[model samples]
Target chain A: MTRMFYSLLLLSSLALAEPGTVIRKTDLRDKPFLDAAVVGNVSSNTQVDIQSRKGAWMQVKLPSGQAGWIKLLNVRTSSGTTSSSTALANVIKTGSSGKTVTTGVKGLSAEEIQNARPNLAEVAKMSSYAANSADAQKTAQANQLIAVQVPAFANSTPTTAPGSNIYQERRR
Target chain B: MKKQFLLPFALAAAITASLSAPAHALDLGKLLSGDTLSKGLSVLSNAGEALNTSVKGLTPEQEEALGHNVMANLLGAAPLMNDAKVQRYVNQVGLWVAMQSEQPNLNWRFGVIDTPNINSFAAAGGYILITRGLWDRIRSEAELAAILGHEITHVTQKHHVKALISSKSQQAGSDLISIVADYNSSKSGAKAGEKGGKALSEIFVRGLDKNDEYVADVNGMVLAARAGYNPYALVSVLQLLGSVNASDSTVALLFSTHPSPQERLDNIDQVVGEKLEGYADATENTKRFNQVKR
Candidate 1:
């Protein structure tokens, strides 16, 4: 009776991670960029807690209480609980045989897509509703979207490593 | 690259195959004539038709025709959400990006399918659709642009048409299927029509070539940047997708049909690499996005 059990640890654990472990030798960088100086390195299967994500980078805290970024592909998350139980948890089944069946869940399930019959009228409508280039250009101008020149990945900014996997996929 | 033999090679094969028909014998009802006329003719005819479908080049006009049927089937699967405001907003964003694509002159239209799943489709002839679920997850106009840019890349690259034509499983006659009347008259053609429908469905279920997908990701980033959006916004959307577990029904089809989100993110990092830090303050257009979304 002298001590009370508080669920603070459990709450905090759930808040910090999906309980991830590194799958390869990974550098912990000061920032998400690969060119950022490596503050430390963690070996394969090293346990770490995932904190946040940016593009391919994940901000993670290591077992040693040090935190930095890791490539998202380098770590695997341990499953805690199944998020949804039903075949499609969010789907709203309006009717089985109805042509226009939609539930609150919103979109078609994979099964429905596989079984769908062609609707020519709808297809025609989709075709007729197209936006011309002038309309598109005006919309962009309204949104203040100024086109920028972006190089193809082959001609991308030079990377720190010459033969990195990042640039290899283009040729692959 | 797919092993797309030249038309002359296919024609040669077809001619050679037709010539090899059992021309040596003719029998009258002792079972020789029955096999020679009926089954033999059917096999040769099926082979010729199959070869025709295989080698036929889909011109830009024919590509649009193929997309029409595919779009019909997609609409049957999931109808567009019935909100004109949302639809127009999405179309505005989509059209802006489409103008920057390879097929900028092709009529471009975008729609939001009323499903709560993470999915998008690019029909040939410049039609793109995204599920409301994925739409809801987008936090900024730039993120929305990023998503549209990826889907639009599929159109610009002609990924769907190439996949549709090169698909060995679907009979080539399906490419010409315009009206139900095309499927109604002949028995063999009817069977081929059914196969064609199933093929369209299967194409949606599986996906385009893996390399095509990778290319879309790379090209999509470039297109987004060109449209005056933060190219990295796609990564934000990808991160959100990656955070969701595969068991979640929201991503059920997406995970099954796509390369894992992690690989896509990694590829993005590779393509953009160290260039990300410089665009950290790129325009996100949060106010406009919030106003148009929902």
Candidate 2:
């Protein structure tokens, strides 16, 4: 029953073609691989329908109805505005009733922070939930998380060609 | 460079003269006199050497205390969510991800603040807080891990601490000393707490250096990958953030404090490019995420 529910969830997610724009010019590959054959080209700022994501590749359908995979980083998905009803749905979905609503009801504003007084009691409570290194390691092991060595700030060189995108001037 | 050296010397001389003079009777003429000036300068030179030794960097204990004080002030703005399971789950995930950071052994604490503002915060010495609104938008554990990883990078890099030191260093010579003193006295009362709180809030309002945010984005993705999660998770989250309308209140603070989502994405793309593509197949752990998230 749980498997079926997840399968349905996956299907529904795929069926919803999220609108996105190619933020940078990228090749549309036949498969989600760098070595994969380039089927087409999606230019910078071209609108596309993002069908689904697999790893770093997103399967997107171009305006001409051609579908192929592109690097997920090259595209920006349209923001699905979180209207009141969606917010209400999220609240209900979390299974926390209306009684707990008071806490997160208002948006946290700068003015609120500037005038706020420190809540030492809440700070103390948060401390109680702190996780130690050993427990964290145990959780990692349970989750089958294998530590990988990734260099911090690995690349300092800019790889993208100049004038490739709108942020070119801002690039260091 | 000459001004930098002379300012500290002059300030230190002034302090030494004030300490030696009788209470409520600072003799300015006597202070400027050759004898008193020489005496104060000699005493200040000794104290300056000691101050230099202590001012190298905040000790680990001091960083933690300052972080705790900042965390308390932030909690004052938005209290922690009253849900132990969610809190514990976030801590476990956050800590596990943080273990992959350079400062793995710091006393890491993670809390989900009960606020609708879609933002996350990282305090020095390993205090991370994510808002409930941000939590609600997270789709998978990998996404959660990525956000936590970004905040983790800030702590690991001592971003906040460095920012604090540099900002304080801009003031008179006594400012840095007073910050250290403030942290030392933070244990006592509400007055100290208020001061520390105001300083942190101002930093949050003014925001970190834009380059620091970009560095966090790049390093954060690397950290998530190190923890064996999909590195693209942060890209996905940024995509989500990018999709939100600029006028939306949920992301107002985040937008104000961070580089625009599109700019962040572009910055990450410039640095990361395809380096993390290899780790794309890493786990998202959506099932466990959903279970805990619900």
Candidate 3:
């Protein structure tokens, strides 16, 4: 089963989907090393836009706009997510109108991107990205990671003494 | 036979000598009655009175002189008034009470004696001495007036003369009154015996008998009431004295000389009986005194 999974993962990487591949692991380390800082994690079968590739790593953009390099063999592509080529075409067509296009292939188009600002409205729209898109998954995963890592009350432990100097005087 | 005649003659001459001097050297204890003692006391009362009446007695100048001397001795004994206000307050109260007293004609000097003992005393002259400790404990001007009245009554009633007569008899039996007057009448002899006379005077002040004490208390209440003081001032002063323990020297002296506070208080109740209706309430005095700082 492991051999089959590895073969399928390699095949998906070579025949990258429109955005390249799907996330192969339910979680990924946020840092480069096995011991690197876990800034966030990803879920398996979650599709993300593969913006660029290096020797053994692919830099993918989650719908939440967080981009990081994951092992090439750890993700496969979905056909619908805009590939770098399509993103480049969209930008050039808009730029040909003598209007400013969005900066990168992986970045959003100027008009659509303006509407798809990464805030509450953009994130709530199901049509903005896949229903269970990698970006959404990563956002959810980041939240979960944060929930486990830091307590909501961590900041609530009184940063200032109750009643200020008056409390201190009473204490004395 | 001649030696026998000489012995009889010598014995007869000795008997004659004894008989000749017999009346002059009689024991005062044997000669004076308690009535005579009371009379002699009235005489001493007269001495204090003579300050007003007779020229031979203490003159205003002499009373002032005595007061100055007493005040000097007092200042030496206990320098008073760390606060000018307390001194002024005492003087004010004392002057007011003196105005109401029988001795209003004479200038009464008031003072605070710096002592921890709760004590107050008035001398034969119009010198009133109050101790700070007593002031600290008293609750009202009426109470202070009562204490002063009790002491002043001792002066006004001639308790000292009775005290002196008793003292003289106790010391010299019959010789005291007879020899003392002759000694006082002669300038040279009295001046010669003035040292001894002063010692007896000290005794008179200190050695008051129980009767003198009772008479003083009885008269003190009348005087205090006459002066518009609440009769209860006597009772309240006694109550304050009673609360202090016996080990307190001032309280002991006060209790020793004055009538038992409980009895005096009761006596006041009986004497002032129906008249209690008219006395002014000292509540204002009490309230003013309540926070008086020691």
Candidate 4:
């Protein structure tokens, strides 16, 4: 019964489809793998509804109602709506008022940084919360986080190619 | 030839003396007198040469001190959030991610400032702070690790320190002298603190080079992956940020300081490609994160 409830919960979460746009030309695959059968071809700037994510792929429904998996990075999710609309969407989607609760509270602005005065006391307070290396290791162990040996990428400047697979050469 | 060389030195000395100790300002005439001028020029020339060499790098101790000063100034802008639990949680996550960095032994400290600004800061040494606004937006421990990993790369790469050095080199003599003067005077009064704060603020407001930010993005993913967290957590966070309206005041400073979210995502895609796909199933720790986040 509990498993059924959890499955229902998962379904409810996936029901909230997010809007996204494919930023490049890519193949929509029947399965979430590089060698998977291609179901369709999505061109740059095609709008779609993102259904779910699996590893480096996202399951999305194209405007023509075709559902398939695309490379996650190829699509840009749309959350660029105006604040009021976002707040309204959050209310309907999350069943809560959202960030509007803190609406009137002032946030840090560029001008505040410009005329800031040093607050040494707060800095001192921040120090008291510092975590040591052993403690950090303990936290990692408790969470079953094993350290891995991923290598550094070759340092390069940003280039204009969006779909270029230049990183393949640097992979060990 | 000698006078021509000495003239700029005399002006620098006059300016330095006036700025560092306004009460005992040295006149250009006094600086130009034969014995005094020769001795002062020799000292100033030696100092300028030292500054030139030192501009290439700072000692770890020097970097820590500068970071401390910058952190204090940042606190002045927005004091830390008062919740000890949240502060402690952030530190644990941050230190764990930072341990995967090259400089694992550095004294790492992390905090969440009280402001609602959607941004994070990385000072020279190992100081990292995320604003409450950004903090509230984070969904899981993996996401927090990814963000902290990004800031940690900034420190490990010495992006801010290099920026400071390059900016100092641009001003060469006078600014270097003033900084030394400021350090010496910092021992006695708040005046030096005020001056340092202003200088640090200008850098923070202007933000780092776009290329440096891009480098941090890619390296941050590597760091998170090394720490056994899903590298895609950062992509999710960026997607969330991209969804926010650009004109929102909460993200005003962040948007100005960073490339637009779409641009950053595009750059990450171009750079990282499929290298991190293997680690996508690493720990997300959503349950513990949700429990502690409240």
Model 2: CA > 4 A from native: A1-15, A78-99, A154-172, B1-56, B165-190
Q: Give the clashing pairs for model 3.
A: A20-A77, A21-A76, A21-A77, A22-A76, A22-A77, A63-A135, B27-B174, B28-B173, B28-B174, B41-B162
The CAPRI quality class of candidate 2 comes to acceptable
lDDT of 3 by residue, B109-128 (tens): 56664444456655455666
In model 1, the clashing pairs are A106-B114, A106-B115, A107-B115, A107-B116, A166-B270
Tens digits of lDDT, candidate 1, B162-261: 4543332233223323212233344344334334444555667767655566667767767777778767777766756766667776778888777777
Q: Distance (Å) between predicted and true CA of B262, model 4?
A: 2.1
lDDT of each: 0.61, 0.70, 0.43, 0.71
Candidate 1 - CAPRI tier?
A: acceptable
DockQ of each: 0.26, 0.39, 0.00, 0.40
Q: Candidate 3 at residue B217, lDDT?
A: 52
Interface RMSD of 2: 6.6
Q: lDDT of model 4 at residue A73?
A: 89
Residue B270 error, candidate 3, Å: 3.9
lDDT of 1 at B282: 56
Model 2 C-alpha lDDT per residue in residues B1-294, reported as the tens digit of each score: 111222223323434544464341322222233231234333444332333322223467656656766676788888887888889999999998988887888888998988767899988768899988789888888889999988998887665644432322222223334533554444433454455555655557657656667778887888889998999989889987877767777777888888998888888778787888888899877455777765
Sorting all predicted structures by TM-score, with the top scorer first, yields 2, 4, 1, 3
